[model samples]
Target: MHVDLTRDSVAMGDDVDAPHRQSLHLTDDASLGDAVSAVLARPYLAQIGGGKATWLVVVDGTVSAVVAQQWAGPRWLADARVRAPGAIHFRYLAQRDPGEVYVEYSRCQGQP
Candidate 1:
């Protein structure tokens, strides 16, 4: 299987540069769901491929699936608000609340 990661990345200046493109290879998995999940999980892709990737094109032989990102990810990974053009989507993975992933830096460990 082949997947294309298209990045409409963000910048501080808010410039609209052309989208970046990268490709991926899969061994056995052939489901549309699986391809989307792999893109969401940021697996095996180069930094430019997965991070900030706003689109995904999954090519399985003659079948091609195009997906878009509705919003930016919490992290730098290429995941958030992903949707296919004509597909019924249930939440792939329910994300945890901010509190669940928060990190506290002021822990008391005494003298090291």
Candidate 2:
């Protein structure tokens, strides 16, 4: 899995209104793990007090899935789980609002 850091917006707990942007490039298919791992590995994720990041899983020029991660705290705890090839669900923060983000597989679209 090749994970690309498309966008990173981070704001510390004290300043939720202010966020900084970070750009990262990760192109090694061998080192890339699941969506959660990839998101956690972002270089700037650990430095932020709290924020959201979006990743695009690109395979041969097409985006297979979109991953969104939001986290806070010293440990940066988050829950990211994939139920299917194109489906992922995750939750963060004290509210624990689960977010279901996925992309329909191109091959499986318009089929029975």
Candidate 3:
């Protein structure tokens, strides 16, 4: 199932005072291929679309990568450690190769 970006909201926690967060939503039904593409598309998700958004990748309840948008992209590789802020981390689990991610936007200066 594809994650309903329209129905979902990205936040730090369930607290009303939690730091407001932006998210790059991917459908739960989205295939692994698509998820990988989305990440790569927005190498700097926080800077591009997801404002303070966390890349929440999960498969079978096992969390995959929890990377910050600013530090995520197509460069992620298996066993690779692409770092960003202390709060972000990317994990490449699916089978894929480099130069596989692509993203475009008319404006990238605001939150998505």
lDDT per model, in order?
A: 0.34, 0.34, 0.33
- Looking at model 3, the pairs that clash are 1-28, 1-29, 2-27, 2-28, 2-29, 3-26, 3-27, 3-28, 41-102, 45-69
What order do you get sorting by TM-score, best first? 1, 3, 2
C-alpha TM-score for every candidate? 0.32, 0.29, 0.29
lDDT tens per residue, model 1, 1-112: 5656554334433235334455645544454455455665763222332322222232322113222233333221222243332221211112223222222101211111
Over 1-112, each residue of candidate 3 has an lDDT whose tens digit, in order, gives 3322211223334235333233545554554446555545753332323343334333333333334444444322222322111122233222222222212111221112
TM-score-better candidate, 2 vs 3: 3
Q: Highest TM-score, which number?
A: 1
Model 1 earns a TM-score of: 0.32
Candidate with the larger TM-score of 1 and 3: 1
How well does candidate 3 match the true structure, expressed as C-alpha RMSD? 13.8
Model 2, 1-112: lDDT tens digits are 3333333233345244223333334443333234435455655333323445444344334444444445331121122232212222222222222132232323342121
Query: Which regions in candidate 2 have their CA more than 4 angstroms from the true location?
Result: 1-39, 44-50, 71-112
Q: Any idea what lDDT model 3 has?
A: 0.33
